[model samples]
Target: MTNEFATLSDFRALLAGAALADADMFAAASEHNMQLTKPPGALGQLEDLALWYRSWRGGDNAEIAAPQVIVFAGNHGVAARGVSAFPAEVTAQMVMNFQHGGAAINQIARVNGATLDVVALDLDQPTQDFTQGPAMSENEFVAALQAGWQAVDATADLLVVGEMGIANTTSAAALACALLGGAASDWTGRGTGVDDAGLSVKTQVVAEGVALHGGQGDGLETLRRLGGRELAAMAGAMVRARCLRIPVILDGFICCAAALCLAKTQEGALDHAVAGHQSAEGGHARLLEALGKAPLLHLGLRLGEASGAALAIGVLKGAMACHASMATFAQAGVSDS
Candidate 1:
């Protein structure tokens, strides 16, 4: 909950000492799952998801009553290179849309009964173009990360961090290629529905960025060099959630990419998080595979702003409902055999 991460080393220290889910609660939840009336493994991943959520919540009968969705917006200098279908100004404009409750995430969060907050990080001043140099200096990176860290509500039981930054997919692709050891084309995608020519341009930009700044072998350093402000904030918020033992449902490719930085940093930095959905973006599936995350939904969603994760809240809610409210075989007068 403290925003004292003044330097990248501070972040490293926090990550190194990050907490894990309550093992006792996890075991208890697992045993409780067996006592439920439903056939064993009938709910499939939902059963596992419930237990996972309970472990982090540190309660045998924990429910996601207070879920928080945060959408971080920032402008990317890389957008100047024509990496996205939309202009960089769209980032700020979309932030306004979110504030006015006109965006898809607003409706999704409201319908799911989750509180939404939008954070804009220095949109008036975009990060440096990574193809030329590091995207953000140490101070800038730390500020962005602290913005994300401070945005988390300690009272929330669940967290979902999304982004609204133009050319951010390009940034995510570059970060992925840098951290996960892949070619740019393998990680690049036509974000925001770019055409064939635009896709090629985006891919080339990713390759260029990676070739220039890749191989640092440090996740935070790679992020400072290649990630956007919103991306860094998402990483920070996820770390904050881990520290608070709040479970997280990651949004899309960009969100996963932000999480990858943390995953690559510590052994189990993302232990409290899960992929909300596999996005329609070309690189999202590969990114999820790299993170060892199986998404809860796959509705071909490419819209960010935590929309996908917000929708998947119901899925977790359903799992928690069954896990918490279901009667045991003996109580229901049902035969175990």
Candidate 2:
């Protein structure tokens, strides 16, 4: 029951402004954190993340609401380049696993009380329709983007975007290079554990793809040239989150590349994004740095099925609880020490 509308700047502005949480919420949460019997700043980034969530919601009372996790699953034809160790069939198999509620993300979402939805965008599905399986037209890319928005519509209060496709990391790196104006070597990272020789091959292959696309700032062109459907759908989801006023949690390196696309596509899409975790990929930190985002955790995880974001949801909930239930120093009758 999501509502779709023409692009509106006023809507985005209103949404952005609404996220500014009140000062009392912050004061209370800080006080509560201090009273937890730990010295101030003891929790480090966890406290910061809690405070950030409190501020983002405009108050401690701002309900997280019906949070939803959407795993955009697709097969990338570019895996033929040895960019990934796993076969592309893994994408479809994982999607089937997700549908059967047996994936890691599924269990994580269940624990977090988050609704999980799988959007199977068959851009490279061989049995279905088109002859051109690997590449996509601009129209198709845009359509996939819109479809992602359409899927998340009113059902999600917050969205966690994840992708499942082998070698799509190459596609993601190339897309990041195109939109963010960097070399493929700058964005490319190891996918599924390539050896030294395989890493060399991967770097060269991604560089060639970036050169083939040849764009300084054209996000759509870059996506059509090297971005997979999962990435495009991810871009669409990020944009739609801004338009719809729902915050989104991004997974790892490949998912961050999708964020890079939306950041370049729209002027302010980055403001609504939350990084779930940092990956072992070398490019992840650089990308997060470029985005001015600090991730919620760094567990050296590279499994990209929104598992990282799912883990962060627990922290986000704890943050909201502190914001809402914490008593201020004055209310607690405690002296500011």
Q: All candidates' TM-scores? A: 0.98, 0.82
**Model 2 — which ten-residue stretch has the worst lDDT?**
126-135
Please give the distance, in angstroms, between residue 71's alpha carbon in candidate 2 and its true position after superposition: 0.4
Q: Model 2, stretches more than 4 Å misplaced?
A: 1-56, 63-65, 123-134, 153-155, 181-183
Give candidate 2's whole-model lDDT: 0.71
What C-alpha lDDT values do all the predictions have?
0.92, 0.71
How much is the lDDT of residue 93 in candidate 1? Answer: 95
